[model samples]
Target: MRLIRGMAGAVLLAGTGLAVHPAHAQQPGFHRHDVLQHDLSVPGREVVQVRVDFDPGAVSVKHSHPGEEIAYVLEGTLEYEIEGKPPVTLQAGQGLFIPAGANHVARNVGKGKASELATYVVRKGRPIFVVAD
Candidate 1:
């Protein structure tokens, strides 16, 4: 019931001239809700925003984007591990920056549900996300 409601806003880009089907592990406990997106002034660049919710113990597996991402914690604790960097656990109102092409993952380390607002400034015509090995 919650998963269905949470998934109602999961919008994926289609007309960006790229067919991006991220082969990410589909976890039922995790959901993504796209909030907004726009073409940046920079040619070939665009910005997108999404709200991600994580059930207790839910995990967003390793993945990478074409550009950069800013993540703000909105609810519970989330641990982010960006490649080549130490793992950081963020609480409500905290934030983290992820460099372009850096592989990363997020885990809900809190007892309750966790949510984060992620904004990405990424290259247009490229996959917003790619599953990482």
Candidate 2:
């Protein structure tokens, strides 16, 4: 139920291209939202631009990725915990990269909402996520 609402909200925001991030006006050709995406047109390779809007006290479900993930925080602060890795905090303007198969989850521990832009290089014809703990 939570996933559905979260995804729906994300979809709506993405479609409307709302205030995706404080820096949205600076980057051209990019969509804005709580979670917006702009796919990079790389032939034979998948490169997608993703934005994550995080509300205070919100934590995402634990999940694992099948591809390499790179992210940059555009606003607010995010707290991340990955399997076997010490938790880290990413403030606005920070970045991170997760290797393939790494289990991880993120939470917005800041006072306000947060946002991030991520890119993934995934295998073709397969989904990218698998729930994990």
The TM-scores of all predictions, comma-separated, are 0.81, 0.68
Residue pairs whose backbone atoms clash in candidate 1: none
**Candidate 1: misplaced stretches above 4 Å?**
1-26
Q: Write the residue-wise lDDT of candidate 2 on 1-133 in tens digits.
A: 7665444334323433333312212212223343333344665446545576776777766666667888788898888898899999999989999888898887888898888887767654444555563
**Best model number under lDDT:** 1
Q: Cα miss at 90, model 2 (Å)?
A: 0.7
Instruction: Give the worst 10-residue stretch by lDDT in candidate 2.
Output: 21-30
lDDT of 1 by residue, 1-133 (tens): 5444223212222222223443333446777675877889999999888788889998765777899999999999999999988999999999999999999889999999999998999998776866565
Flag clash pairs in model 2. Answer: 20-33
Give the least accurate 10-residue stretch of model 1, judged by summed lDDT: 8-17
* Candidate lDDT values, in order: 0.77, 0.64
User: Judged by TM-score, which candidate is best?
Assistant: 1
